[model samples]
Target: MGVFTFTDEHTSSVPPVRLFKALIVDSHKLIPKLWPQAIKNIDILQGNGGPGTIKQINFVEGSQLGKMKNCVDELNEETFVYKHTMIDLKEKFEFIAYEVKFEPTPDEGSKNKMTSMYYTKGNVELKEEDIEAGKERALGMYKVAEAYLLQNPDAYA
Candidate 1:
């Protein structure tokens, strides 16, 4: 078992509270609709929209990722912190986890800053390049959601 960790941060024009609501709260229903080209559905398999919930994200037909499961480890709406453990999507990536913190940061008059910490357990020795693919996927998803909110100001307002 090889363990590796890294963090990636994104800045957006959206406010922290609004972004948190849209990303953590409304994502279950909104993500699939917003990114139908990549994600087909997000189904909550267990628990409420809180800690201990197990959710599955189904990818669009013919994608490399057919489906992926995640366990909500922690969610704090007040502090805008979210942590989830990802089930193995592909055989090589055995266990992947994330702790994401959303905080208001000063940046060109925007209140959006997202810090994502990722932990991955690989089946064999992992290189930095091996991890970029997963990080790109996460970034892609976040950007899509952010774009949706940018276009619809009233959404999750």
Candidate 2:
């Protein structure tokens, strides 16, 4: 099996706490509504949405990453950080494993950053187009959530 990793990072002006709540806590509910073209639905498959919980995101019909099942690795509201990893790809990823982390930037609510790392499995070399496609979706989700929060102002408060 070949091993490889790729990371994508982005910073947003939306405070960490607010961003964390909307992105990590409420994303399952918001995403499908915001971009029905990108994601169809998100469902919690096991547990109660805490650490060790398992969830699945059902993408739109034409999406390459058709569907993904991920295990919640961490959910730290105090630190404004959330970590989740894909434990079961089900053929969605070119890699054997993938993990994403959303952390408060600079330990302040002024900014937030989201980082995603992918671990390829076996000798399969991941194509940049496929990888970037996933990253774009992730970042697109963030922007949509950010826009929603910006418009609501009091939401996720």
Candidate 3:
């Protein structure tokens, strides 16, 4: 399988604890509220906000983004590190696996370094244009969430 990787970094004025709580713990409820046009809903299929949890993300109808199933693989609250894998990709292209890791920058003011990887099935061909589009969408989603948190500090507390 071919491997594709994407990385993003953002500095948040909010504290790391608050940022992690909002982005990971309450993400299912907060994301749709922040970007209704892109994410219609996030349904938790199993477990709480810990590892082994399963989630289904439903994108808004007619949106370029497609739906996918995610499973939390690792979560380190003390370090604000989170990792998840795409268990299923029914709506989009063929991918054997996908993983995202969020790491808090030490000595930085609530900054986070995020890395994402996608392992595609060997036979499946992924176009560069499609990958670029996905990256843009992901960044857009993060920006929306950041904006929401900036506006409402008490959210997800």
Candidate 4:
């Protein structure tokens, strides 16, 4: 198995706490409602919303979409950092451990940094193109969520 890591950052106009509450805390419910084409649903397999929680995400229709099982490894509410391990993947190319950090800027907003580390095995190898594509997809989802929150600020509350 070969391990590879990818990092990307994005800035949000919303506050860190608000972003965290909407995106990380309530994503399982909000994502499907907002972007149904990208994410079909998220099922909590174990725990609640804290550490050790296991979640399975189902992709939307079309293409070779697959499910991903992840376990929340670490969660620091105060620091706004969360880490998860991808325990199962539908295919050979999948993320292994994904760590995301939300840093609140002094300017009143927040910056999101996502680091995805993965291993390629069983006739599959990680590629730069695949990593870039994944980054784009992630950013697109975040952008969609951001827009949805801007329009429906009370949806998560």
Compare the candidates by lDDT and give the number of the best one.
4
What local lDDT does model 4 show for residue 128?
Answer: 73
Point out the higher-scoring one by lDDT: 2 or 3.
2
**Regions of model 4 farther than 4 Å from truth:** 90-95, 122-124, 153-157
| Candidate 1 lDDT (Cα, 0 to 1) | 0.78
| 35-82: candidate 1 lDDT, tens digit per residue | 889899999999998999999999989997799899999999888888
Candidate 2 residue 85 Cα shift, in angstroms, is 1.0
Cα error, residue 55 of model 4, in Å, equals: 0.7
* Model 2 TM: 0.83
Provide the RMSD of all predictions against the true structure, rounded to 1 decimal: 2.5, 2.8, 2.7, 2.2
List of clashing residue pairs for candidate 4 = none
> On residues 77-154, what C-alpha lDDT tens digit does candidate 2 reach at each position?
787667778766544344334444455556453444455566655555668786777678778888899899889879
lDDT (Cα, tens digit) per residue for candidate 4, span 1-157:
6788778888887767767777788878887887787788999999998999999888887735567788989877778888988886656655578788888888877899999988877668777777877787678778888887778767543
Candidate 4: lDDT over CA atoms?
A: 0.79
**Residue-wise lDDT of candidate 3 within 57-137, one digit each (tens)?**
899999754787878887777777778877766533454333333444565447767676767765556677877776787
Clashing pairs in 2: 1-122, 2-122, 2-123, 96-121
- Ordered by lDDT, highest first, the candidates read 4, 1, 2, 3
Superposed model 2: Cα runs more than 4 Å off: 90-109
